[model samples]
Target: MLIITPQELQTDRLVNQLAKTWQEHGLDLETMLKTLREVRSEYTP
Candidate 1:
């Protein structure tokens, strides 16, 4: 008996696509927040 639903399968595929995109672009999610904070601080009045 199959237990996985169509929605679950689609969601998994979407997550994989994002991970692949990040790798192809050489972008790191970990540094995203820190980079944003630094930019904001540098420009903050």
Candidate 2:
């Protein structure tokens, strides 16, 4: 069995809400991967 505190529950809810918002805005996997590659190219030695 596992226990979750109120704060943890709230954090999880917030994360889920943010994820839903991102999906609604079309922040899909391909967009995220492209952004990550661009950022890495800028900062990598």
Candidate 3:
């Protein structure tokens, strides 16, 4: 069984809005993820 809470719903909406805003700024989730991985690698040793 699975259930979704009101807080989760709100967070989902917020994430959607953020993703839209990021797209408008010329960055999508994939690009952000790839950048994060690259940055982490640089610091990892």
**lDDT per model vs. reference:** 0.82, 0.85, 0.92
Question: Which residues of candidate 3, in runs, are more than 4 Å off?
Answer: 1-8
lDDT of 2 by residue, 1-45 (tens): 999675557889887987888799989767888999999999999
Query: How many angstroms is residue 3 displaced in model 2 relative to the true structure, after the best TM-score fit?
Result: 14
Q: In model 1, where do residues sit more than 4 Å from their true spots?
A: 1-8, 33-45
**Model 2 ranges off by over 4 Å:** 1-18
Q: Against the true structure, what is each candidate's TM-score?
A: 0.47, 0.49, 0.67
lDDT of 3: 0.92
Instruction: For residue 22, give model 2's deviation from the true position in Å.
Output: 1.8
Best to worst by TM-score, what's the order? 3, 2, 1
lDDT of 1 by residue, 1-45 (tens): 879754557879997888889778887777666899999999999
List the candidates ranked by lDDT, beginning with the highest: 3, 2, 1
Q: Best by lDDT, which number?
A: 3
Please give the range of 10 consecutive residues that has the lowest summed lDDT in model 3: 4-13
lDDT of 2 at 32: 80
Candidate 3 C-alpha lDDT tens digits along 1-45: 999675557889999999999989999999999999999999998
Looking at candidate 2, the ten consecutive residues that score lowest on lDDT are 4-13
